[model samples]
Target: MRLAHGLDINHPVHKAMVELGKRLEEKSNGQLIVKLYPSGQLGAERECLELLQIGSLDITKVSAAVLENFVSDYKVLSIPYLFRDRQHSYDFYDSTIGKDLLHKGGDYRLMGLCYYDAGSRSFYTKTKAIGSPDDLEGLKIRVQKSHMAVAMVNQLGGAPTPISWGELYTALQQGVVDGAENNLPSFFTSKHYEVCKYYSFDEHTAVPDILLIGTERWSRLNERERQWLQEAADESAIIQRELWRKAEEEALKTIKKAGVKVNYPDKHPFSEKTRAIMNMFKGDSIAQKLIRNIKSMN
Candidate 1:
């Protein structure tokens, strides 16, 4: 099996993939193997998904925000303020509704294996701090190539610019974008703090990363192979969460030392600004039901 992703090799997700390969090898008694291609050697998130669909790649990981483009059900995960807290989001992923959403992409030849903790996303800017949605006025905020992300940024009163992750660093340096939003670890690892000095903990969204397998490759696996692979992936998710927690702590300390101005803005105003994003999906019954079900979770 070949697993490819766009994250750096030091990323928690990549470390978890290493764990997956080790566990799968142990479970299969050396009969099955997983080859990893990190740092977008094959392609970006969308390109990796396309490769998976055609059986050119066996597995890949992507943000739920990116997955929203291939599977409409995944749009729920990108909604701002959807999950109350980290544990709340974890519970939803382990719930039946979450499992159902995983398979919702089968018709598109994509199958979700599991969800990895991506932490929450917050805003970081180069010029001024984003204390509130009002501060975002006229600022160009970088967003992923997902409609939900675009809408969320628009709702927050910023101009949304979709750019590939690889091109973002240059884009930030050249002032093509005024700012971007992401988790602490990503901001630190990507070294965006060098250019974007202000980091705000508005934490508007807690989007998880998903491990995906193509249906074409999945169909070829025998029952035993499937069980072994699934077990490996399930265990990897647990390992990945712990790694992510540690990375977040280290990233916070490191970025602070690097002279990044970090602040904890009141989340209510930010949440309130994006509240209407839910209404954007009112016409889609699947999305509406998902919203109701997720909110009902304890």
Candidate 2:
């Protein structure tokens, strides 16, 4: 059996997937294999999801933020200051609630497999270091294609500009936006550091990259094949998490050598600024209950 997986090869997680294919082939005695479409050869993350819906793609990796539009329950992960830290985020995924969130996309024809570590996102600016929430005033900040992200920026007093990932470097270089938020590894890989020099480690959101199979394609696999694929994905996640940690450390080191100014501003002010945004969830009983549950976790 041959499976096609889509992801940007430049990403470390892609390396783990390649290792997964190798392990899967060996475990199945060369009966199963995976082919990867790197560099968005298939298309952007959203386009890839559409392909999955139409039964034109087999498996793809996407951020939870991108998957939120397809799975409403995923929006809960985007709430600022939701997870206390990195370990907390990892622990949540290992919980039943996390497993529940993965399966929540079944209605959208998505069968969740496992989560790959994507690291926490933070803000980096071109002209100045953000030392306080007040410093974000009037600055044009680029956000991902998620409403929650835009709302967070707005609550912090910055103008939220939604720019696609591929266009962000140019957007910052040409003065289209003053800054953007993303993981440290992305800042180095996308070469956004070349344009944006100051990085403030506010560490707002921790969104995991999801690996999934389309239910359309999943239905065709035999029981043995399904078991093998699931085992391979679970093992690959362990590999991906370790690589992500090393890559983050390397990325921070590389960018700092390239003349970037890094800072650890008082995050309390930023947290206070986004409290109103979190309160919106309290307005609805369903969302309020979910929020309490997330906060209750270890």
Candidate 3:
């Protein structure tokens, strides 16, 4: 069977994908083989999703935040303060809400295999320390091309500039964009912190990395093969979460050593500012249901 994998080479998510591939090969005893195309060799998340739709690629990893652009239920992950902490995040994923989300992609031809850890997102800037919403005023901040992300940034008073991750370093360096928000490993791995000197620990959204397979391709797999792949994905997720936690700590240490002034701002202020933005979604029936469900979880 010909299987194709795609992801950004340096992304921790890809590391998890590699682990998944390894497990699949081991479990199948050489009957199953997967060829990985990391570093956007196949394309970025959106492009990869498109490829999956046409059955051109077998599997890929995508940010839950990006997946929200296509799957509305996914926006639940974008909600700030939704999880009490890491444990809460994991519990929610293991709950009914998680099960529903995994199947939510079926309509779009993307089958969610499992979820991987993507550390909490925080602010990193070129010159200014983002202590509160006030500090974000007037700054041109780069965010993923997600409406929710853009709304979150706008609520903080900064001009939200949607930019792709690949071009962010140049955007920051050339003043095409001023700063960006992401997790520590991403900030370090993407080398965005090199241009953005201030690393703020606001810990905004804690979206997970979702492992997905093209539904078209998955349908062709025999029942036993499908079961084996599902089990392998679950094992990979467990391993990746552990690695992600370690990577987060190491990333923080590495960035600080590189002279980045890391600050834990009064997150209350940041949270408060975004409340208005969140309220707008209060009327969204689907979003409201998800918000209620997550808050009810723990």
Candidate 4:
């Protein structure tokens, strides 16, 4: 059977996907093969999902935030500061709610296989330090095109510019965007830290990179093949978490050496500013229920 794997090259998700493919091949004894297409070679996240809808692409890695556009229930993970800490995030992902969120995308033809930690997103600016919400005011900040992210930036009083990741460095260097937010590894690996001098560890959002397989493809697999693939993906997630932690540490070291002023800002003010945005979804009982569940978790 022909299987296509879609991902953006240089992304941590792609690194994990490559390892997962290798493991699946070994477990299947080469009977079930996977074709890897990185660097958005197949298509962007939305395009890949469109392909999945029509049964073209077999597998892909999509952000839970992006998934929210199609599967509104997936937006729960996009809520900033919803998790107490990394352990809280991981523990919740292993709970019933996590499983429900993963499967919720199936109604839209995307089936989540596992969650890959993307780490906490923090602000990095080229010429300023975002030590507090007031520091962010009037600054043109770049955020993922998610409504929640854009709203969070707005709540901080900054202009939320939705720029693609590939174009962000140029956007910053050219002064199109004053700053951008992401985890340490991404900021370092993308070399955005080179242009951005200040690294504020506000730990705004802890969105997980979700690995998904098209329901069309999954349904075509035999029970044994499905089990083998699932086990391989699960094992790869374990390996990816270990790799992510090491990457985060290395990124921090590299950025400091590059002259980035690393500051640990008090997140209390930041959280306070964005708290009211949650009210926008109050009418959605499911989302409200998720907020309650997350708050109650340890």
Candidate 5:
């Protein structure tokens, strides 16, 4: 059997997953081989997910923020300050709840295999530094496709602009957007730091990149094949986490050396400002319960 995977190859997670394919081929003794299309060869993250749904692609990885468009339950992961810290987020994702989430994609023809550590997202801006909620007023900030992200930015007094990942560099360069937010490695790897001078460590959200296989593709595998595939994905996730941590540290140092200004602002104001976003879900019993459950994890 042969499978195809797609992702932005520049990322450490994708690099680690490529290793997974090598391991899978070895473990299966040539029963299964995997092909990879990195650097958006398949398309952008959202496009890749859509391809999976239509069975045009066998597998892909996407941030939970993007997945929220397909599975509303994933919005829980996008809630600002959802996880207390990195360790807390790791603990929750390794629990039963995480397994349940991975399976939630089945309803959309997406079979989630595992989650990669994506680190925490914070803001980076071009002309001004965001020291407080007030600093965001009137700034057009690029956010993910997730409504939670748009809501958070809106509540914080900035205009939320949802631009494609590929367009962000130009968006920042042409003043189409004043700034954008993402984890350290992404900000560095994508070279957004070249356009965005100030990096703020508000560390608002921690969204995991989920490796997913199309349900049709998954069903095609026999029990033994499925076991081997799953084992490879599980192990790749472990390696990806370590790679993410090291890349994160390196990104911070590399960008600082690139003449970028780094600021660790008071997070309380940013957090307090976005509290209203969390309340928007209160009317829905299911979402409210989900929030409480995640918060109760630790």
Candidate 6:
């Protein structure tokens, strides 16, 4: 099987994928092989997903934010303040709701294998520290292409600018966008900390990365092969979560050493500011139900 993703080889997610390949090979006794192309060697997340739809790619990892484009149900995962904390997020992923969201992409030719910890996303800025929603006023925030992300930023009083991850560094350098939101590991690994000197832990969202296989490719596998692959994926997710926790800790320490100012702002105001984001989906019964279900988990 061929797997591709846009993350750098040093990323915890990439390391998890490596573990997945190793485990898969061991379980299948060399009958199954996984060829990985990291660092966007094959294409970006969306392109890789498209490849999966056509069976050109066997598997890929994409943010739930991106997956929402194909599977609208995933938009629930992008809602700000959706999960109470890391444990809440994990509980959601392991719950029936999360599992249902994972398989929702089957109609679109994608079969989600498991979730990987991408961590909670927070704001990192260049010129000013975002201590509250008022601080975000008049600022342009770079967001993912997902509508939910744009809506959250807008609701929080910042102008949301959707920019591809590959172009974000230059966008920040050239002042194309004032700041961006991402997890600590990404802020450190992407070197965005160099430009965005302020790291605020508002922890607005805990969107996870979804590991997906092409439905066509999945159907081609024998039952035993499918079992081996699923088991490998499940185990890799556990490994990735531990790796992500350590990475977040190290990223905070390293960014501080690099002179980035980190702050843990009271999250209530940020959460209150973005609460309107939920009502934006009131017309969508499915999304509203998801919101209620997720909140009930907390």
TM-score of each: 0.99, 0.94, 0.95, 0.94, 0.96, 0.98
Better model by lDDT: candidate 1 vs candidate 2: 1
Q: Candidate 6, which ten residues in sequence have the lowest lDDT sum?
A: 274-283
lDDT of each: 0.93, 0.84, 0.83, 0.84, 0.86, 0.93
Q: Candidate 4 residues 182-256, lDDT tens each?
A: 898888878888799999999989998888888998999999999989888888888888888888888889889
Order of all candidates by lDDT, from best down to worst? Answer: 1, 6, 5, 2, 4, 3
Weakest ten-residue segment in model 3 by summed lDDT: 1-10
lDDT (Cα, tens digit) per residue for candidate 5, span 1-298: 3233333567788788887898799889988888887767767888888888888888888889999899888888998888898888888778888888889878899988888999999999999888998998999999988898999999999999999888889999999999999999889889999999999998888988888999988988999999999999988888988899899989999999998999999999888988888777877887787778789987
Specify the poorest-scoring 10-residue window by lDDT in model 4.
1-10
Candidate 2: tens digits of C-alpha lDDT, residues 100-216: 778888889997888888888899999999998888899999998887888999999999998878778899999999999999887888889999999999987888888888888
RMSD of 2: 1.8
Work out candidate 1's RMSD over C-alphas.
0.8
When superposed on Cα atoms, how far off is each prediction in RMSD? 0.8, 1.8, 1.6, 1.8, 1.6, 1.0
Best by TM-score: 1
Report model 2's TM-score to 2 decimal places.
0.94
Q: Which residue pairs does candidate 1 place in steric collision?
A: none
Please list all clashing residue pairs in model 5, or write none if there are none. 9-39
Q: What is the alpha-carbon RMSD of candidate 3 to the true structure?
A: 1.6
Local lDDT at 166 for model 1: 83
Candidate 4 Cα RMSD (Å): 1.8
